[model samples]
Target: MDMEILKVDRLSFRYPEEDRATLDELSFTVKEGEFVVLCGPSGGGKTTLLRHLKRELAPVGTMDGSILYRGLPLAELAPETAAAEIGMVFQNPEAQIVMDTVWHELAFSMENLGLPPAVMRSRLAEICGLFGLEPLLYKPVHELSGGQKQLLNLASVLLLQPRVLLLDEPTSQLDPVAAREFIQLLHRLNEELSMTVIISEHRLEEVFPLADQVLLLSRGALQAAGGPREIVGRLGAGQAPAQLAYLPAASRLFLGLAPQAAAPPPGASPLTVREGKAWLRGLPAAGAGPAAAPHSAATAQPGAAARAGEAALLRCRELTFRYAKDGAEVLKKLTLSLYPGELLAIMGGNGAGKSTLLQLMAGLAKPQRGKVELGRDIHTGYLAQNPLLYFSQDTVAAELAQMAEYAGLSGEEAQREIARLLDIFQLQAVIDNHPHDISGGQQQQTALAMVLLLKPDILLLDEPTKGLDPEAKERFASTLQLLREQGVSIVLVTHDVEFAAEYASRCALLFDGAITAEGSPGDFFGSNYFYTTAVNRMVREWLPQVLTVKEAIQQWPDSGSRS
Candidate 1:
């Protein structure tokens, strides 16, 4: 067996005010040069366990355990000694960054530790090169993109040359491509530098292939621990929640129509798009006939509803927008309208200007030319992709209450409504906690709750479900459905093709700052050239309109919903 670098023995911890323990009798070990992944549902004590590893948990909390580093008790080490030996990259980069410029940010910790100027300069160069941060060294931390900011954070931590690195959902704020790139970089670091890595993240499909071991956590306890093959096998068998099932997009397709299709071989686990495609191609194409094209019922008349002369709730007449001093337009002579109570999803690849268009609609960025008009009496609420920008209060509850008051609600009514919204987002218990005290997922839920409090007639959400688990995503979809029933229109920008197919009534594909395609979710995703959801692509071989696994299973021909 590999040498044990760290160990947790009979560990248990709880918050000062909590009656129940946050970590209950949890024990685990990290081997040198190993990559371990920690995952479970939200608020399952993953973050608490990470705190214990870093020795940052408050001593006042109830404890019945110890953590060892290299056979030495962590509690015996000095705070500075521990900081130098155990580098931590938190989930939120903004929370850890202390300097305005990227270069200063990387050097802050080294300088604080009193490293020699010559040594610091050399280490900075080497670490920056590894993370591709040379170009961003002089840039202001505030000006950097989300992915770049995260890379900087990791680079700063890497400067310490710690034997073990703990990353708490490091890429939760990044896009799909950036997230994959970051994980690949970590894999290389482990191989070349021999760093032991432990990551708690929701992007399992991206990181599972690189993990040496997987640990499952549930309700402050270690539910299971094993190698990737064993964990994936159990997950494929439906022994895991829908969120932790790392089946690829292709397998998800077959699993929807035939749950047994997700079963892996005796010793192999599938966790990538390539692996899934291979598995799917290898399977016998046995099932019902090809599904009919999406929205075949509506495509026969392209503009039937438009020809009926209904007024649009929001309209853009040849809208065009561009940043100051940039001659090139970001939104070019585009025309679109959002009708009341409609859930519209906009899909696109990276740098396709999906976010820019959403910002234009929300009035955050004015169009350089043309017009964007909202109907009279149509209230609007906008949720940015990064909600951290809107936080100002010391605690989550206070923030929600302030927003409620802004909407002219009485203090008592606001408190009541805030309580209800917190519960909806599963944040009731953490209401009084500091805004910075919660997890990334929890902060996102808080942001969504804040927006919903306004009760707008139209909601503009940009990547609202980016960091949410499958269950949270489902709940959000339900909330949107409820809002639609209450006569609220939704305009969402997202990369979740599967989610769009499952919940969006209408869909538009944005490419190069323009809408290349527009139709119902089925119609938009049914195309051969455009991007599509896993379930839709898989079911396209048998059922045309199936976009979600639940829909496929519940409405399968044998289930008696077929005509």
Candidate 2:
């Protein structure tokens, strides 16, 4: 068998208006029956490379070199033929789905390709069974959870029975459980069907262990490519300086004080929590040095003016909302209060109404019952889960300029702020580009910048880190910390439990339309059930109160000061 099912030979691509190539001399290959994961920071050409694999590059771009499928040059093949053999599941499911219902969406692709009714029906059933999507067959696309939509996208593509599957960050929008399930299904497809899978993703801990091959891309170039062990070993050696350092949180915590403590043995490698735990258990405990220091919680002095005034920044009383008359209530008799200088995270399963709750809080949707009251002096800012919806203007700069006008900033000040945001997000060159033309992460940053400029007393964000790479997520977290220090009250809904555990002051778990638990981040994440970070889970067995690395570090005796 040909080892290379798909190959890029010194491929280079550049948009017409861009001075530099978006992808320059990038080359890689995916073998039959192999699972490959392509990872890198945003705007590093992972998406561009995937687009090239599917032959979906725009006419304004120029391509150099060749892409071959089964030793046949892909550029020479008809578009339909290429698409039929090379199935693609896009980052945004809504962009590719054309039909209303899930059943129609699954069947539409095969029907358009002229498959017979019998073949289509059999294929659909097989795909649904393979992905555990049988129950979602008749549901409308809009009604499905973010994860379900991703699964539907995959199922729709699987109906074609393509030789190679190309997934572009398919699980980025899913909750933790749903994301894990999706990855497991993908593994089954690769094992049972021997389908070649090429996925670009940021959730490394979820996908890395399952990947047969891992490729790292940086600055639109292929920086490294090899099997998972080889690539990760090179990363551990600090060879890929430009790539984001995304060690397992557990490993990072221990390695911080004991730099060489958690390094894998000569021939052994561990990437996920389970593997790391096994590795940790095998090693004898480092001789207990000093007793851990006593816990000292910080306390704020009275009459120290709070970030925002004493006024209630955001409040909800008996909030209730339902999707339809017959549908189950999503937010049932929920009441909450948020003050300035507080960072609160709402977490739950995919269908637990986290996004719905955020929309209601942001005043984007009306509650079916009860009341949501904003303080008289409070201004509200919102960052949506799908930031693309916030873009009405054409260019990135234009969007910020419009937001500046609304915020009563002078043109010069608006320009300065826009430049500052663009610099921080590393989107300086793309400021004049259309929002739709940029990557999803860049668009998210732009939306966030616009929201921050509003400087509202309360900010509402829905999955702000959904599609971002690890580096971007870290940067966004730091930015949120700065905002909190400035007296902004943040109410964010996300599936990123680790982020919540690290950054949030308080956390609320939503289930069946109501909050089942609420408390300080430590208390909420320390619980075994509900949404909790991996680090929290790891240390829960050892230290119950440790919810974050910072907290764990502080628990150590030698640590100097707490942040």
Candidate 3:
């Protein structure tokens, strides 16, 4: 049996100003070489708990707990020994990076450890090769795409050869392909190097299958801890807490389609897309649902008929954009139209210029050719990818008030709107806290609330789902649906394929600086392989139209139990 790497015993903590504890008597143990996944709803103390494990970054707060690393108290360990033995990668790639160039960032940590030049060079070469960072070794960190930046951050952390790696939503900003690749790298490290990993994330679709152990938390308390299959069984039996909604698409489909009493016997829950497909094939058909059809690009215009008579709220015709006079074009001859009340999702790889297109549409940046046209008297609001760009006030409440004033609302109207937003975001507890002091997800919610205050007829959001937990994402989707009902058009540029497939009325793929594909969610995601949602990938052979867990449950036989 593997030895215990870290042990937490009856841990509880609270910030200085808060009355209630942020982390309550949490007890858990992680074995060496284990891939542990820690997850829960937003603001549930995941970040706080991770921080406490790393002595240097632990938050200053009232605490009563003991964290032991390899049988030694983490607090009593020497600073250099702790730093070299344990490594942490933050949620925001930009937050943990310190140097200007990729090579410098990798060297910074080793230099502080006073390692010899030969040893540093040897370790750097090994890590760069392992992470495929050799080509980008000399590149300035700012010029790298989100995926590259995140990869570089991970490579930097691994250079020290830490025994245990802790990552806090490390792929929150990466594209789907990149996120999958990152997760695979984590798996490789755990299996080959025997490097223990503790990751806290909301994107459970990919990581759930790779986890050796799963830890679920809620409001700073450990709700469940077990094998991934065991947790899925709990979710199926309705025995798991609500925070366990982070279940992968496969497990979700199995639980939903399987009968209440048929929770799939012990640890037999389907955990992967392939396993899900096999399980689905073995199921008895209820009514012979629609036959799966081969998807083709010809289905691109399926949504055009729905918007036939309505005028586009915003249109970009043959738009071209580039950041510099001699640089390559970011968006070339891109033409798109957004109908009123429609939510259009634009997805692509890390550097495919999705954010640039949103900026051009929002009039924050100009196109070198063609033009962007908006309906007469139309108002537009844009939420930047970086939430910090929109915040000016110290506290979230003050920021919301400032936004309300800017929207020309005052007194009772402003108060009512502010109160509603606070409740919807579940941000009332942190209303008086500084936006920067809160968690990344909370900052994202605060930014979104501020954007809504402007009351624009057209809203442009860039990666609006980043850093959000499952429950928060559901709330955001519902809010988006409500906004659409009120005739507010939205353009979302995101790498979150699942969110786009389920919530966006239409989806478009941007590739090689141009729109390569566009269609309704069913037509677009259903036709995709790697770029589609987990459910679509799982059931594409039997039900090509399914893009979400709910859709799969509805289409497949839900009552029968296969013996």
- The TM-scores, one per candidate, come to 0.83, 0.90, 0.95
Score each candidate by Cα lDDT.
Answer: 0.74, 0.76, 0.87
lDDT of 3 by residue, 177-241 (tens): 88998899899999999999999999988898899999988888998889999888776776453
Top-TM-score structure, candidate number? 3
Q: Tell me the TM-score of model 1.
A: 0.83
For model 3 the local lDDT of residue 256 reads 72
**lDDT tens digits, residues 311-365, model 2?**
5577788899888889778889987767678888887888788888888888889
| Model 3 bad stretches (over 4 Å) | 239-241, 260-264, 286-289, 301-310, 557-563
RMSD of each: 4.5, 4.5, 2.2
Please report how far candidate 1 places residue 181 from its true position, in Å.
1.9
Instruction: List clashing residue pairs in candidate 1.
Output: 291-543, 291-544
Candidate 1 minimal-lDDT segment of 10 residues: 299-308
Please name the candidate that would achieve the greatest lDDT relative to the true structure: 3
TM-score of 3: 0.95
